[model samples]
Target: MILPPHETQAERDASAARFGAELARLTAAAGLPLPPARRLTWCTAEFEGPPATPAPHHGAEPGPPAPDRARLRGESDRYPPHLTLYRGRLPLAEGRPPDLLPALRAVSAWLAGADLAAIRRTAPFLHVQEWAFTHERTPLDRIELNWRVRMQGLAHGPYPVAREDVKALWEAAFAQPRLRRLRPVTSHYTLWFSSTPDYPFERVGASVEPLHRGGYLVRAGGGEPATVATAAEAVALAVAALPPEPV
Candidate 1:
């Protein structure tokens, strides 16, 4: 598993120091104004992708190791910790907060100057997130409506099923009963990859490509992509992934 950028308070402090310096460097390079205290904050989301790593030249600059793409993307109990482009609730720097997001987006654009899909990904992934239980929870009805694409549902007790059918499988497992407590549910369209020897990327639909991390020029989307872990889980999701209305 990839070690997080700021796994501890001390590490966080160290990271902040380095980023402040790096941001200054970036500002100078771009001829942008620096704020008194530059900070960046991460917004809540279904799941966080990998944190940005400093460029290669920043290797010896004394910072946390970048996450391991392989392990972070693999099935492992140990996951990488996450921090935004900056640290803390407020990303503070001596200089003005640089336009980090725009910078990131700009870099992405520059990297993918022509082919929009060149660095883009559209593979499906199972994102499990916690939700509020406004109502009491119940079990599946055994016979109920199959979920359409992007329907709400949960991961199975045994394991996850095919990525494409995650929605259907989830809806089937927890067919519309009220819930009391919060629990983890599947979030879709979260996982994608370039062609890898271990986990290959195939077309799940129209416009899909065979290349893993297929975007040739630049790669976007950051975060851990956890595939369905076990054999039983795959089978369960596979069964759940069956078509809603049979021909």
Candidate 2:
């Protein structure tokens, strides 16, 4: 990360431009479709509840996705590629260094193209095999729940999942660690978007309407609405909406 001593905003933009251009060039060289970058972050909800999930056996095919179970289940020797989009930022309080997030997103459209599998793959990180995620989700906890929320993003390719298609992966993430219901006014919302595409965006479990000019009119669950200009602003607004934890 560039520190204050080394650069100004203009300098940073120059650096990011150089970085993005090279990254795109190299990505093209690799023969992989250059997709847009989706942003991410960590929070108490994702980090505090569970243990790491184990990897899937090599060559094993996943079973049909179930939606009721509240657990994410899977095994993969490889890290969940989702984390890479966020610079491998895991949802742990004590793992990974504080992110150089601005830099990671500094060069938006670092790659070319418009497909969204990259964003869909990381949706709410449901069922992450923690170990695999940041790079994992267990896959079974909220398959249905996640699908319901991420349906719009993942509804492409051969097996397009419809809202009616939801079936529980598991009923819950953990029985003992029951999630306390929020007092009617409380909720958590997250907004992730790709700056490269100008307007392509995703709301994780929140309802938002896109403005043709730019920005979004976001109304999370039962909360009041707000107009925000960027994914970062949206995340901050959502985090700010959280009711203070009881002291």
Candidate 3:
């Protein structure tokens, strides 16, 4: 078996600092000034550069030198220079570097032209949207829901929810005897029930999402979602929809 490289916390931090430094250098070199501090408070600009060095790895006691170990680590991870565009702390776009100078120029132009209202309106949808730019022209002003192509469910835009409502929904779901066996996972404004208790939660059994216009949409076993006006009605519908056997 191949042993993973042993990396200390300090070493990891140093590596991160190096990456950040390189990204900053590239941003300047490309003439893409960072957004103002106030703008950055709500959004961020980030770059993902090609690896500067080969990754470290362990080998047999009398094995090859460090250089050789890096070679064995494989070349697939060494991608081309790219930007990791962000909204707040979350990355909105990554992977597959576009033309470096062209992309940076597009980003610069976008930053200069974009307004606070536009950013504010787009920020919440960043998780389910994608943005791209090229030297040919700056990207479109609007961010679209491109997530459906990759992910299923939610035939329309994202389901919006308030923190207070989410807490109330979680408590209400827990109080339901039928849903007690299923684990509750709240993500992307949707509350999912899964048989597995851990992160992967492979066995999803039901879901509840708040409708944009008002009301909650509850679904079970891949069936159609049913909307109800009140949280009590939503919870009751969810409990009734669940499988009779314990999940």
Candidate 4:
């Protein structure tokens, strides 16, 4: 997770602790049993770009390094530092009860055996918010899929759910909502995190101009700090090592 340079290690630790505790508390309050928190790998496409312009409070500290302009388009100030693609939350069979490690491992191995050419054909995209001044637009034809593997509790807290039940739930939630709006967007993964504790907003909002140029920003995060993968390469490595699919 990206952090402000100005914060001390103690502050960072404290913040993380608070975040975790609140997460746990909220889950329990929702009447959802907490899933066994374990280390798992996830995959996502990230936008390679420059660090954001810091807020006024950030003036005391030097900002992140500048991005490479040669490889990027438009003004350097046009976009945020990152955008995520697919995110998978790996399930482990141990401490949490229904260990999904075996099934996770199986999926990883299967991915390894499968050809990435098909996957890569759908090169990752950074969805950026558009700005009236920029007059930018995202290409509609790109193939994008955000895949994730996570516990049902983490995905939809307080409400007990299983992998098999996700499709129906999603249809009821997302599909139904979209139908009402007359807009349709297909999602290839499950929604694990609640809309609360809105984080990464700084990073997300910074690229509003670019996002409008693109269609949407795809991002994912999991319960364990050790499990989050920030880069696509790392996610691929984990997927390749995953075991076979569970029966």
Candidate 5:
């Protein structure tokens, strides 16, 4: 996986330290206490398409491989997983939070009842080339929704207050300057995945797939979903039927 822009490891570390200090101060000012941080799990609901045919590039040539479902699954895992342009942390309140778990269950219910067929039909494939500079450009036709469900679950098991407080905390947190700068798209889901230390982005191989034929593929070593969307309408459609929260 491509690292964020920093000249060296030392530079990256220094920057992180500085940011962490600033974040601590901000959290203090927000009247919010930091709960035990947990790794976030996430997946992308991408547009359906054919897997990109492997081709030779940069002084290399393509090699033929057998076309078996098991092999294809393995091959698909070798390519770069779809990128998540945005991420947010959801921490549970101390002394046990309320409505958090229920909120997650509510979201789960909505997702369980989600119409995958509509998402497939409405959303179109976004070529990798289109995402070359996603870090700089605001995504078009995509809204990335993030929630801190795992931390909430750990803090309070299946409690209704956990969900409510979490929603409030997130709403308040989103209004902060740091989060506003991140510019997340609306209408996405939060699923559990391995933490950053074991994040799967690094395992993505260098292959592009066709958009319409293969559907989304899993990256090798990274169990995260591979999906991409380029249109806001499609994102809205995906989340439109989800449970609504008062902002």
Candidate 6:
């Protein structure tokens, strides 16, 4: 398995500072101006316990979190707070003039933290329910920011290739006559075949990895890899290099 990178708390803090600085600069350039009352402000709440149990009747208007439970705070991976954009405000109707989309996007981007795609999608979206602060308050944005922040703190990265994209390739490779007896193991983007069930990383007989532009790269134990144009060719190459099954 590919391990994630490690970082100290101090390092994470520094990264957060850098992210905040860039976000501020980008928001300023987004072209929306607001008064102090309407400007976004970070706010947080601490629940006393495992919710009131039975979770207040459905559709019942929720009250403000206890005053002591609420406070304005800075960014944090745990117990992340939200930025309140407005007080008792209604959403702008569709096609409203002056288009406050920029402000909404800024808030969403802030909440999305390091998730580049989420930030991009928020620009055209006015509100994201998952990230909402409160029903009475402005709709929240970037509900997943806290998780993203934690992942960022841990230096986790998105997978290079989606598993679904390579499912067929693995299936085809496993079907090859010479490779059929070998068990396929995966490590991130790589697929390895080993006769042993344990299949230690170093002992795999053959491995295949997808090339960036378009192709499969096949490698035999510690040997140079050969890039093939198609999955079929890659499977054939790997099968040829694989060791014969035990008697």
Model number with the top TM-score: 3
| lDDT at position 13, candidate 6 | 54
Question: All candidates' TM-scores?
Answer: 0.22, 0.24, 0.33, 0.19, 0.19, 0.33
Clashes of 5: 35
Please report, as a residue range, the 10-residue window in candidate 3 with the lowest summed lDDT: 66-75
In model 2, where do residues sit more than 4 Å from their true spots? 1-139, 143-207, 220-224
Please provide, for model 5 over 1-66, each residue's C-alpha lDDT reduced to its tens digit, 9 standing for 90 to 100: 112345676766665455344434544555433321122211111111223334333211224421
lDDT of 3 by residue, 1-247 (tens): 1112325766545544444454456668866764322211011223222222332322111222221000001012323333333322223333222333444443443344443234334332222233222201232211111221212122211222235555566667766765665656666778776665445776445678877687788887767778888777878877776656745
True-vs-predicted CA distance for residue 31, candidate 3, Å? 46
Q: What lDDT score goes with residue 34 in model 3?
A: 47
Model 6 regions lying over 4 Å from their true place? 1-165, 199-202, 245-247
Question: Roughly what TM-score does model 5 have, to 2 decimal places?
Answer: 0.19
Give the top-scoring candidate (lDDT). Answer: 3
lDDT of 2 by residue, 78-172 (tens): 21112222111122111111222211221122122111244234232322232223222332232222322233222321123332212110111
The true-versus-predicted C-alpha distance at residue 154 of model 2, in Å, is 3.4
Give one digit per residue, the lDDT tens place, for model 6 in 1-247: 0112226766545554554444456546764331122222222211111122232322222354221111122334332222222121211111111222343344433332313235335443323333233432332222122222222222211112244436556657645756554455567667776555442533446688877677888888767879988778888877777666579
C-alpha lDDT score of every prediction, in listed order = 0.26, 0.29, 0.43, 0.25, 0.26, 0.41
| Per-residue lDDT over 3-70 for candidate 1, one digit per residue giving the tens place of the 0 to 100 score | 23445677756655554455456646766433322232121111112443443332122355332111
**Candidate 3: global Cα-lDDT?**
0.43
Tell me how candidate 6 scores on lDDT: 0.41
By TM-score, the better pick of 5 and 6 is 6
TM-score of 6: 0.33
